[model samples]
Structures are given as structure tokens and as C-alpha cells.
Target chain A: MSGIELKNVTKRYKENKFEITALENVSVQVKAGEFVAIVGPSGSGKSTFLSIAGALLKPTEGSIMINNQNITDFDEKQLSSVRLNQIGFILQTANLIPYLTVLDQLLIVKKMQGTVTKEDKAFALELLKDLGLENKEKKYPNECSGGERQRVAIARSFMNDPDIILADEPTSSLDTDRGHEVVQQMAEQVKTRNKAAIMVTHDERMLSYCDRVYRIVDGKLSEEVRTQEV
Target chain B: MGLALKELLYSKGRFIMIGLIIVLISWLVFILSGLGTGLSTLSTGVLSEAEYSGIVLEEGSEFSLSKSSVNRSLTEKVSEQEGVTDTTPMSIFRNSVRKEGAEDAEDKITDIVLIGLEPDSFMEPNIIKGEAWSNSDENQVIADESLENDGYKIGDTVVLDNTDKELTIVGFTENKTLYHQSALYLPMENFQNLRPSSPDDADVEETVSGIVVQGTDVNLETFLEDEENVEYGTKEETIEGIPGYVAENATIMLMLWFLMIISAFILGVFFYVLTNQKTNQFGVLKAIGGSNGFIIRSVISQVFILSLVSILVGIGLTYLTVLALPESMPFYLESNMVIIYSLVLLAISVLSSLFSVAKITKIDPLTALGRAE
Candidate 1:
């Protein structure tokens, strides 16, 4: 089953003096177990596309189907529910709450929606164990190394068992070895959890781990047609 | 709620500094509020409790006991009007009195305002000691507690000056002092007899400085206005007549209210600065599917908790200061409606926190993605 579908989507921002076309006529699809990479440079509208797919930004035109329901029409509250229940996001930086312990960082998402159930706690522990942070749950963000913090952040992203993970630049701050390790962990989660993962990155070395790779130029997504058959 | 608590604990220095500012300003407002109430009591303690339906004074003149005078005959005429329950003649005169024995006996001869009253008038109800002043020539007088230092007990005699007649200190009263002068109550006749005169002139006839009347008799004012014999006033008019009482109170209260307004804005601004610094954290929470309502609730709850604690400290400090005042200070710590009013003032600071919380609602969630660096 496909986890996400973007059909003929567009996004624009109108400022007081000018209108910036951020994304135009973009369409993409990812099966439940696929690992997809979106490659682009700084001003290529890749961030805007990830923002729309993650439900953080409303599209200026066209539709988004997540888990078979068209989500472009969702109200603020409904969109928030979809994000809470279905989507996990990773940004360029770790974005760990500096005040929270590694464990509390994961629990905050579950607690905000409701109380944290025991099964949720177990799942969080399982994710943290797989990310090699099993013994570091009690440490504050500042006490952890940069690589450790990013791994904790990845654990947090999947805490809700989301069906889709949208990582803006998951390895931009990591060294070559740690960056490959992070990408390998994301790819493993996509296959093991039967969830689709889309990573927006400028690092071409990370492309081999993705099941499909596409490049965004100007405002549209394009790829070699032979790879789409996969 | 728990997350906010943890976050504040982690950044204890920032929140505590804000809390300390709240404490200092709230303490100031509390003390000023107490003093404003206390000073007003010292100025108008007697009038506030007299419970007269109306005070009568000269219509065209400023209402002051010293400036408004009605003859004894005029009060008798006013008593004839309908709804006129009781009319008591009063006279206020400047005089000096001294204890019969003291080290600085001449210095002990302090300037005082002699408020002369009929044997049992409406205005003299707060007599806390021996008895009210009587009309007999036995020279009996009632003094406020400021004279406590002089050891003038009941039956002790003090001289009102060169007159052969003497005043026996009969009682001590509380909170009856006029502005800057200890008030002494004496018989209206004694007051008239003590009025100053040229050395060779004849003695002034016995008459009261004013009349305190009860009931809603509207005709008495018109009758007094037309009558050439004396002046009369309604109670509101009489209260206005007290010297500098209204103007002084209005100025002080205005200052106190302005301070409260400034404190509210200061608190609102402080919270704004705090919220601005946390925008990235707010964005991170937003990216994780945290609703705007959740983040706003957390901010408002933090401020509400901080303000309530600050007000508690402020009230505690004010209470201790008020409790230490000596009885002879002529200040009153009122115990009625003012308690509820002070609570409302504290609540305004708590209510002011909502403005900062509103700013959180306008933050765009998309900023979480692009804004993260």
C-alpha cells in the first residue's frame, strides 16, 4: 500500500511587495516500505515540498492523499491530528528540547495528545535501544554528544510509530561515517516498520541507501523514468 | 503542565528574576495601598462613622467645619422642618492645652483643635474611654490617644489657658484626630467661651460652628439658604467642606492607580521578552504536532503561577509592616471591603499574563521547518 500521494501540488507565499512561487505542479508517491530521497540545492523549493507533505504548510493548490484520505482539505485541527498520528519529521538540526532528558524528549509528543500508555513507553524504549541510546535516556540534551543527540532525535521522530517519516536534512551536521550510519538507521526503520521514509538532503552520497531518488529543480520533482518502475 | 514546570526549573535563573520583579513591585503597591487607607482614616475617621443622612454647610462656600457656621437659633429652626430627626450643634475652634505637670510643661501646651459638641451628638460615637463630653461646667474634656504620652487619665485636669475655667481629661478616643492636629472634644459652650478676642472686647455669645442633622428633609436646605441667621449643608456637602480632605485624597489615589497600571504593563512586557526567546522551542513543539492551544496553556499557566506566588509574598510583607505600627500613630488598618479589593488588584497581574500567551497563537508552524538551523 502507498503511504503518501502528492498530485499536482503548488505552494506560494505572497509578501507585502512580491509573490514568491515556492513549489509548482509537483507530484510524487511512496509505497509503505520505500525509502525515497529528495535532492535539491538551497533555493530549489525542496524544503517547501517537504513542509507541504508533512502537513506543516498548506498547499496553494492541488491535493495530498495520506493513508488513502485526501488531506489538503483538513482544517487546522484535523491536519494536526494527521501529523500527530501519521507523520514523523526530522529537521536540519537535532532540534532536541534542551531542557528535556533524552527519555522525556520522546514522551512529550505522546503526553501532549494524551497520557503515555505502557505500550507507548515500551515502543519508545525499543526505538531508543535500536538507535544505540539505550543507556543515555536519562541525560539532558546538552550532556549528549552531537551524534548522540541526533540519534535521540531520530528515536523521538518515530516514537508515535508514525506511518511516514519526513527528514529535511537528517545528516547535514554529521561527519561522513556518522552521516552514513544515520542514513542506514533511517533505511532500516523504513523496511522494518513497513513505513515510507522521504529524506530531503543535499548530500548525494546518501542516495544509494534510498529505494528511489529524485531531484527537485526550479519548482518541480523529476527523476529518470527507468527508476520509477521500481 | 509538567513539561512547563521542568522547563522553568531548567532555566530557573530567568523565571526567578521575573518573579523577583513581580514581588518587589507588588510589595510597593501593597504598602502604598495600606498607607493611603491609613492616612485617609486619620483625616476623616470621625466623619466616616457618623452615619448622618446629610451634612449642612454654606451653599456658596467650600464646605469646611471651620468655614461653615450656623447659630444655635438656626439649628432650632431647622429642627422644625419635616423629616428632621435630630440636630446637634458643633463648634470647631483652635486652642492650646497642657498637662498640669510635665518636664517641658510649656512645650506640653500643644496646639489642638477643640471640636465642641452638644452633650450627645451623632458625630462623637467612637469614644473608646471614660465617657462623651458633658454640658456641665465641671470642665470635662475627651482627648484622642495622641495625648496618651501626657498620661492624662480620666479625672486628670488640663488647662485650656489663662481662663479661670479648667478642663478635666475625661476619656481617650481612637482615630478622631483631624489632619495634623489632635482633636479634643468639649462642650459647645466651653468652645464658644474659649474663642479668641481683642483684649478689651466683650465675650462672644455661645454659638455652634455647624449643625449635624439626620433624615432626608429637603426643605431645611432651602430654609437655611434663605434664612439670614445661619448656614446649613447636607452630609455630602459637609464631607466636601473638610479642609483639603477631598483634593489630597484624590491626588494620592490617582498616584496609586497609575502605579498599578505601570506594573501591569511591565509584567506584560517581561513575559513578551521571555516568549520571544523561546520561539524556536515553540516551533520544535509545533513540528512534533503540538497544538497552539497546548503551548499557550503552558505559557499562561506559568505566568499565573508566578504572579500568585508574588502576590502572596507582597501581602505577607505588607501585613507585617502594618502590624508593627504603634497605636498612637493615628493610622488605621481597615478590615472590610479593602481585602477583596486588594485581591482584585493581584488578580489583574495574573490576568495580564494572557497578553503574552496570545502572542504564541500567531506563530506559524511552517517556521519550525525552515526556521530550524
Candidate 2:
């Protein structure tokens, strides 16, 4: 009951007068400790679905629920609060602020919540240690490797300990070995934290670690069962 | 604890450029303001040395002390009016004089304003070097201390041009200047002896350029309002009435206003450009639950800190530069004016950062969703 549930969500974009359907009645349920992967080609509503579930965008016609409360109709302030307390996003390319060190990157999330306490610092350090970034706390983003930077972003996303984590192409910028390390860390953090999570990726090789796989083609979604060894 | 401060520290080179601009602007403003105050004070130094209820002049004399040749007997009539404490008849003349031992060339001639007043009145300047020039003393003058810098010592003979009246410098008074020239105080009998006629060309009856009034302002104003021949001016109006005083002050004041506005615009543009460069960071912050309020406060706080530090440094620089200047330079900075203007600059600099705040408010976190680098 305390997980993200999207019920028949549809998103439309009106560009200059043309009403283009971006998503057609998409429904997905991601439960606690579940890592769901969304696979799609170019222009297949992957970003649109991730945006709506992450509270970055509102569906044109649908109700999105988190902990049994419909957040689709929430105002801007309420939506921002939900984003802060319930959802965490790991975007592509890490997106670490250039000025902040790795440790400050995680603490900044808590700072936005209100004030960062000593307990928050310990929690941030624990999260970084879980992601194997204990020594990189004082290092800036540019000083870290691509895989290490992505791992720092993962730790930052989990710093708030939200119920659900959403990642959009979390490994697009990493190479074969670093990409595996990044995605594996994302999966391990989700499982160890018992948080429901969703990742939208086009890389077929990264799908083996997922519990379930869903494919979207031309704004339509269909679940595909696959045999994989985690 | 502020993100703004951390970022400003991390990017010291970038913030220093804007800070430098602000410092230079504040420096220029302080210098101009000091000179403006200096110029105005230059024309009113003599007025500042005395306390007065009002300066009573002829009604149509345009406040020019020279144009007001009121009857010397008018002082008696005003002294009898209610609220009148005392009255003194005064005359003034701009004369060139030579020190007894100095060359008599045009270059050696010094400009001095001779003020012939009743030695017993309150208008008498405090004698510093020697004794006061009493009415009984013949050709005894108390020269301003500035004449000392010009090599005229106390007890030296000062000869007035086109006249046989040779005044012996009896004493020296400090900081008494008339229309930016040294004031030489003399007894009325000795001063009138040096002049062929009254400068205002009054009738043969005893005439005076103006009356120094020492009483309540309301009484002087109301009483003068009924008198057809005379009017009253408070200290401030008397200073403003000096020729070219209002225009010079106005021109400098206009420049100060425009400089403040221009500096604000420059600060606004600088902040706007920096904010635009950091849009990616702001978007990522908003995506990860950073509120717009937090970001706006960060921007404003950065502007406030930078502006405050820069203005303080500029004020320090002004004080240092003032120490290096010669005493003759007519530059003065009033404490109140400095405080008021510094606050205005700080306010404008902070207000200008609203430009960056507006840009931050419009940034959508969605831009951070599918972007790289």
C-alpha cells in the first residue's frame, strides 16, 4: 500500500496546436524492494513515464498514487514536498553540482529538507560508504571517475531514504565495465534499502539485474517476462 | 551554512571581478560626494563659524550681502522688536593686499575679504594668535590663519590697494573664510576709513550691508515680513543664496544619482549572466527537491555580502586617500552623508540581484531529467 502505483496514466503534449499523445493509458505498479526496468527505443514514452512517476510532470489524464494518496492532483508546493520526501531521481550523467564535494552533494539534499543535523551527516557518510565512496567524500565531481561520479549520484538519491527511487538512463555515459558497476550499485542499494525503484534504460544488457521488464513501443506499454540469473 | 557563500568561495576568481567593479564604483561615489561637500562648504565657511537667528538683508537684494545697504539705524528698531536679543551692523569688501616685506607684483597680491563689524558683537571671530581688534584700536585687523600660510605674520603691516590705510595684523583667527577667501576682521571705523564709499553705494547717512540677527526665527521672519525694506534668511538659505552655489551642487548631485543608478544596472547584468551560466546546476537542484525559495535566498545573500564588503573597502580607500591630500584641497566628507549614501549603494546592489532571482524561478527541473553534463 505504501508504494508507487500508476493507474492508466496518459500524457499529451500540445505543440503549436498539434495534440500529440506521448503516453497511452500506461499503468505500472512497483512495490517495495522491487527493481523494475523500463526498456524502450527512441521516442517511446520512457522519459514521459519516468517524469510522471517522479512527480516532475503531471499526466494529462490519470491518477498517480503513492502511499494510497493521489498526488496527480497535488498543487506545486505539495508536489515539491512529495518529490522531496517520497521520490528520488538519478538522472543521466550523474549531474553533480560542480562546486560541491561528494559528501556535500549528499548533505545538500538534507539541507533542502530543513537543516542538516549531525545524524544526517552520519547517514550521508554511511550511504557513501555503502556505494564505496568513503575516500571520495572530499573530492569534487570532476575529480571522480565516470563510474565513481554515478555512484555518488546514487548515494545522493538514497540520502533522503525515500520510499521509491527513479532513475532515467542511469548508465548512459559509462562504459561496459563502469556501466555494470553503476547499474549494479543502483540495484544493490535498492534491494538493501527495501525501497521500490524504477529505471528507464535502452541498454538491453543492463536488464538482467531487474526483477521485471516492461517494453514501450510508440507510446504503448507491455510487460515482457524474461529468464535471467541475478 | 549558505550555499551562496560556499559557491562564492569556491569560485573566488569569478566573484572577485564583480566585487572589484563594485569597489571601484563605491570609491568614485565617495570621492565625488566628498568634493561636492567640499565645494559647498568652501562658500559657507564663515557662516558656519557663527550662530544666528537670521541674516537680515534688503528685500530685493537677492540675498547678496553687498546689495543690502540698510540704514545703520535699522538695527535699533529691530533690537526694540519682540524676540530680538541683539543686532549688529556689518559691511564687507573684497580687497587685494600686500605683506609689508613681500614684492608688490600682481602674483604676490593676496585676495582677502575685509569684514568691518562691531568688535563687541557676537560676529567677532575668536582671536587665536594675538588680541582682538577693539573699536579703539586704529588699523588693527585680525587676519584668518590661512594668511599665515601665505607668509603674512601677526603684527605685520598689510597695505590696501588704492588707499593709504595700512592695517597692522593684530591677531589671527582660524577657519573664517568668506566666499572661499580669507576673512580679515577689522573695527568698523578703521574699515570705513580704508573705503572711499560704501560698496553698496548707500546715502551719506550711516549705512550697513546687512544686520546680523540673533533672536528667534519666527520673530525675525514675521517682523521682517511687515518691513518693506528688509527680509530674513536662515543659515541654510544664506548658504544657498551664494552665487553659483546651487548650480554647482545640483550638477554634482545629479551625477551622483546617475552613478548610483548605473552601478545598479551593471550589478544586475553581472548577476544575470552568472545565473544563466549556472542554470544546469539550479535545474539539478530543483529536480532533487531544492525549493525556489532556497535558491533565491542564496542569490540575494551572495549579492549582499559581496556589495557590503566592497563598499567597506572603498570607504577605507577613501579615508586613506584623504590623508594623502593637502589641506588646501576643498574636500570634505560629512559623516551623515557617508552613512546614507553607503546604505543606498548596498540596497541598490541587493535589489539589482532580483534579476537573477527571476531567472532562477523560471528554471524547470524537467530540464535536468534527460540531459548530460
Q: How far off is residue B142 in model 1, in Å?
A: 3.8
Winner by DockQ:
2
List, residue by residue over B1-373, the lDDT tens digit for candidate 1.
8787888889889888988888788777777766776677667655655777665554454667777655566677677777888877777876777766543644567667788887767776577878766546776788877776555678877777655346887888976666656778877766676676566643345345667777764467567657764555666666656777788779878987898788888887888888888888888888889888888888877777777777777777767877787655544546553465457656666677777777777777777776465
lDDT of 1 at B367: 71
lDDT of 2 by residue, B1-373 (tens): 3787888888999999999999999999999999888776666667766777667788888877866767777888778777779888888888878876455464488888889898789889888888887545568899988888888897799888667468888899877877878889888777667767756765634767788878774376456766888887766777677777789889999999999999999999998999999898888898888889988888899899989999999999999989987777778798888899899999999999998998999998888985655
Q: Candidate 2, overall lDDT?
A: 0.86
lDDT of each: 0.78, 0.86
| Tens digit of per-residue lDDT, candidate 2, span A1-230 | 87899999999999998998999999999999999999999799999999899998999988899978899888777887888888888989999998888999999999899999999999999998988988899999989998998999899999888999999898899898888888898899999999999999999989888999999998899999666556
Residue A44 of candidate 1: its Cα lDDT?
94
Instruction: Supply every candidate's count of residue pairs whose N, Cα or C atoms clash at under 3 angstroms.
Output: 10, 0
What DockQ results for candidate 2?
A: 0.72
Off by over 4 Å in 2: B48-53, B71-91, B116-157, B164-176, B185-208, B212-221, B326-328
